[model samples]
Target chain A: MRARFWIVASLGLAAAALLGVALGPVGLSPAAVWAALAGHGDTTTVTIVQAIRLPRVALAALVGAALGMSGAAMQGTLRNGLAEPYLLGVSGGAAVGAVAAIAFHWNTVVGVPLAAFAGAAGAAALVLTIARIAGGRADVRLLLMAGVVVGAFANAAIMVAYATAPPESVRGALWWMMGSVDGAEWQRVTWLAAYVVIGGGALIVWARDLDALALGDDGAAALGVDVERASRRAYLAAALLAASTVAAAGLVGFVGLVVPHMVRAAGLRQYRTLLCGAAIVGAALVISADVVARTVRPPAELPLGAVTALLGVPFFLFQLRRLAARS
Target chain B: MTAAIEFRDARVRYAGAGGLAVAGVTFAAQSGNITAVTGPNGSGKSTLVKALLRRVPLAGGDIAIGGVTLGQMSLRDAARRAAVVPQREEPAFPMTVREYIALGRFPYASVWSTSDPGGDRAVTAAVERAGVGGFLERHTDELSGGEWQRVRIARALAQGGRLLVLDEPTTFLDVGHEMAVFELLAELARDGMGVLLITHQLNLVARFAQHVVLLHAGTIAAQGPPNAVMTGGILERVYDWPLVVARDPAVGAPMLIPLRAPSPVTVHRPMET
Candidate 1:
């Protein structure tokens, strides 16, 4: 069952990547896209596929993979089905950093992501602290409440930053915040890949700890897990993934929140399989969403984040209802 | 032999609470014996188990598992010596029964180690012993209450510890299933494993437990053989309720039958229309 899930997910991801590269403003055939990928096509086709679409698709996949795995780790460690970096205020905090960098004109490739990382780490710490203070870390309602409050604060901070920025920067930041991968570069893709690989690898290694954590703090401790340390490590890794995705793309919503549920619904419950499945499926979802975002309107492109949110919000509501009924 | 687990004047105090939850309680659970701790609500029965599991730190005094003081042992070391079945647990995410039972091997499974033949053998044995082999592939959420309880016991058994600790293990179980659990614990104890049980089932404790400790107001009100601890005088006083001790017809062990508060006899007056 696990092997079959992997095969299907991989095929879906490949198909989505191909579609992302082939269908765009210029609209190249799959054949042309294939030739361009091999560096044997016409210059225009080569430049369009290799220089523009290839990097964009790669960025989308990496960002999706990062968010997907991070979401799984967060959900597992927190033992809350609704726990995701986006919903937990980690992404919002990263956006705060990215927006601040843009407002101050410190838009260096490395500087923005680093600032975003710091902000994400800080936000994760703050949310945990708030949850701890409210009662216990095991209180799912308290944790979500803390996340929502922190997220609201981050949005307000972004608005204040926008108020002081130049019109051009504000316009660009608005599009970015809504989320797009329009000008994807190899440098950005490489950096995001590094973050995803390292952070996602750490999550996979700590998957057992995550499995134990699902049994509750006392339960995990009785099973020989250092609950506090394991949770902290998971939070850091998840924060890194969330921050890097925000730095790469803008505020792409719900990929993190939705992907793990999709994987679990497919019957992969263990953390290792669940995390890996989420990464593959997330890549496919985002790549497909990006394709639709670019193609939906001929001359104008939809925000990638907006497209995902459209699909994700309904799924989130459905999940909420299911949980309520169960409890 | 030294006790498999010992709590010497152990005390546990929750932060912001006015008093110690487990106040200077001392006891030893020996191998090949079932030691039962029973008490009313708020009498610190569960608190002692928590301290033994290292979930709560000892405010004063010491707890030792397998002759090693808790302060000197890592969580893994402690787990290697003792396994616990908590009073209640619901998996946050449902997995197959096989996967759930395999979690018991976590203490022995190294992070980098992918496979463990020994752990697998232990898990298989546990499944057989707990009689949960029939539904190994079913998800935990699909299990009935009895099945879930047995599955938890299987997980604890698979941990391969010499000392088994359970907190209210029979809660929510039907009469037959509850008796089965008690019998299983007794069987394990007879096989030279130390079993520490904290429960409200006084009658079952009397029948199966070799040593009984009755707590009241965070102190040991009585401790001795079941026959000594199960007397109506001690039980009624500790429980603060009216009850009688009767001999079990089958096992001859003491059985407690709690009585409702006595009501005054009054002549029935018909209600006027």
Candidate 2:
């Protein structure tokens, strides 16, 4: 059963990546797309596929994988289904850093993600502090509320930072904040891949600790897990992944929130399998969503973050209702 | 041989609380024996257990498992020495009984260790012993209360420690299952594992436990064999209730039955209408 799920998910991701490469404003046939990928096609077709669509699709997949695995890690460590990077203010925090960097014209690949990581870490710390102050970390509602407050604060900070920026820089930051992979370059894709691989690998390595954590703090402690240490490590890794994605593709909201659930709904329970599955499925979902975003409006492009949120909010509400009923 | 678990004037105080939750209590649970701790609400039964598991830090004194002080051992080492069935827990996500049971091997397995035949054998033995093999494929959330309780016990058993600690293990069980659990504990004790049980069921403790510790207001009121600690006078004083201690016909263990409080208002007999 597990192997079958992996096979199907891999196939879905491949199909989604194909569609993402093939279905742009200047449509290309599958045969052309294939030939372009192999460096044997007409120059325009090759440039469009290799230079334009390939990097975008790859970046989308990387961002999606990062967000998806990060979300799974967050949800497992916090033991709350609603705990997503965007919802937990981690993305908002990263946005604050990335936006500041852009406003200041410090657009280097490493510099932006680094600043974003700092911001994401800060936001995570703030949210946890707020949750602790309100009651305890065990209270999911309090954590969510803390995230909302931090996210609102991040937005205000972003606006304040934008006040003194050049009009062109502000325009770029604004579009970036709305989330678009429109200018996907090979450099950005390679950098983001390193972040996702390192951060997501750490999450997978700590998957057993996450499994114990799902049993609650005391339960995990009894199972020999250093609960506080393990949870903190997971939170940092998740924050890093979220920050990297925000740096690459702006705040693509709910791939993290939605992909883990899709994986779980397919009966994948263990964290190792769940995290991997979420990565594959998340890549497919985001790539597919990006395809729709560009195709739906033709010449005018829709924001990738907006498209994901449109699909994610309803699912979020449905999950909330189920949680309410259970409790 | 050293005691399986020993507490030397252990003390625990919650932050911001007025008094110590577990106030300098001392006891020892020996291998091949079942030691039961019984107390009323807020008398520190669960707190003592928590202190033993290091879930709560000790304010003063010491706890030693197999002669190694808690300060000297990591959580992993402690877990290998003693397995615990906590008072209450619910999995955050859905997992099958088999998957849940595998969690017991956490202390034994390392980060990169994927599969362990020994761990598998332990899990299978636990499933059989706890009688939870009937629904290995069932989700934990779908289990009945009794089944969940038993499943938790099975997980502890799979942990493969020399000592087992349980707090209120039979809370939701029916009478038969409750008896069966006590019997299982007895059987484990006979097999040379030390068992520490915290419960409100004095009668079952009388029948099963080789030693009993009675607590009152975070302090030990009495500690001895069942006949010595289960006496009418001691139980009545500690419990602060009218009760009688009688002999069990089946096993000759002391049985406690609390008496009703005297009526404050005299009831007039109903007229035959």
Candidate 3:
């Protein structure tokens, strides 16, 4: 049964990847997509399919999976359904890092991601501090409030930076803040892939610890997981993954917040399965969402972050409503 | 032979607390014995158990499982020596009873390795021993308090450890289930596993526990065999109320009952110097 779930999920992700590569501004047929993938196409066909859409799709899938898997790890450790990267101040923090790089005209390869990592680490610390003050480690309501306050502060700081930036820098910062996959290139994809592998790998490795943590911190300790060490490792890894997503493709919101919950509700209960399942489902979700963003309007590309939240918020509310009815 | 757990003048103080939660308590629980910790609502029985389990820090002195100090032992190492059945704390995820029981095998299995055959055997034996076969596939949240309590015990048993410690394991149980759990603990003790339980149910402790430690205000008020420690005077002294005590008719176990209503009177038993 578990194998079947994985196989189906992986297949869906593959299909979405193919669809993403095929559907863009240049109306490429399936044969054209295959021909481009096979390294045989007109320069125009190859340029659009290989140079533009291919890198975009890869980045989307990688970032989506990172966010989804990180979200699953966060939810499992915190034992709260609402514990997502965006809601935990992770994305807001990463955005600050990326925007700072953009606003200062630092166009180095790794500069923005390192800045994003620092911002994410800082935001995570503040959120944890707030959670601790509210009570013990991470009560759900206090965590949400902390995330919101941090996010609002980050947005305000970003506006202040924008207010003082050059016109070109402001455009770049605004575009990055709103989040887009249009700027994805091979170099960015390679850098983000390394980040995802290291960070996402940590998330997958702590699967059992995450499960034990669902029982509570002290309970996990009694179960033989070094609760403090394990939680720190998990949280930092999640922050790393979330930051990588922003570094690669700005701030793609709602994918992390919604995918893990959807996977759990679909009957994958264990963290091992949930982590892997959420990754595939998340990959598919963003790949398709990116496809819609690029093609829905002719020359004007829709913001990828807006597109995901547009699809995500209604589903999130429906699930919340169902939960309310159940209780 | 399996060794005993020894507490050498152990004390635990939560930060910002006015006094210690469990203070300078020296005691030992040997293998093949049942040790009961009993006290009033605020008497620190729970605190002592938490301290021993290494869930809380010991501000003074030391605890040793077998021969190694608790502080020196890793979390996994400690779990291999002592398995704990904590109070009924619900998991956030809706884990089924079988999956819940499988968590007991966590210490025995690697994170990368799934479907551990030895772990599966332990889980199966624990489920059978704890008698949770009926609700094996049901979600833990769907089970009654007693059913969940039994499953929690089974999970600890699946830890494959010798020392079994429980914190008010029978609080939500009915009379029959409570007795059944005690019998189970007694059976484990007879099989040469050490058993330590913190309980408020005095009558059951008298019948089942071989050694009883009466705690009050972070101190051991009394510690000995039930007959030696469970006197009416001692009960009145600790509980601050008049009480009657007698031996049971069927057995020589101590039987205690309140003899009169309090005039809202209280006892302030002086702390030992």
Best by DockQ: 2
Tens-digit per-residue lDDT, B103-217, candidate 3: 8888877879755668988988999988999999899879987788889889989998888889899996899888888998998899898998889888888989989989988
lDDT of 3: 0.83
TM-score of candidate 2 against the unseen true structure: 0.94
Clash pairs for candidate 1: none
What are the per-candidate TM-scores when only chain A is compared?
Answer: 0.95, 0.97, 0.93
What is the C-alpha lDDT profile of model 1 across A1-327, one tens digit per residue? 678888899999999999999998798888898899999878999999998999999999998898899888998888888898877889889989887776778888777888888889888888989999999767777888899899889878877777777777743655546678879999989988988999999999999899888888778888988888999899899889989999888788889889999899888987887898999999999999999998999778899989988988998899888888888
TM-score of each: 0.94, 0.94, 0.93
Each candidate: fraction of true contacts kept?
A: 0.71, 0.78, 0.63
| Interface RMSD for each of the candidates | 1.3, 1.1, 1.5
Pick out the ten consecutive residues of candidate 1 chain A with the lowest summed lDDT.
Answer: A169-178
**Over 4 Å off in model 1, which ranges?**
A104-106, A129-139, A167-173, B263-273
Residue-level lDDT for B162 in candidate 2: 88
- lDDT by residue (B55-166, candidate 1, tens digit) is 7778999998888898898888888789988776778988899989999999988786644669999999999988999999999989988888889989999999999999
Looking at model 3, give its docking quality level: medium
Please write out the lDDT profile of model 2 over residues B1-273, one tens digit for every residue.
899999899999988999998898999999999999998778899998788777789999899999989999999989888998888788999899999999999998888774466999999999998899999999999998878888998999999998999999998789988988898889989999999999999999999999999998889999999999999998888877779999999999999998876674653433421
Q: What is the C-alpha RMSD of each candidate to the true structure, in Å?
A: 4.2, 4.4, 3.1
Which candidate gets the maximum lDDT versus the true structure? 2
lDDT of 3 by residue, A43-148 (tens): 8888888789899999999988998998888887777777788878888898888778877777566888888888998998998898888885556668878988
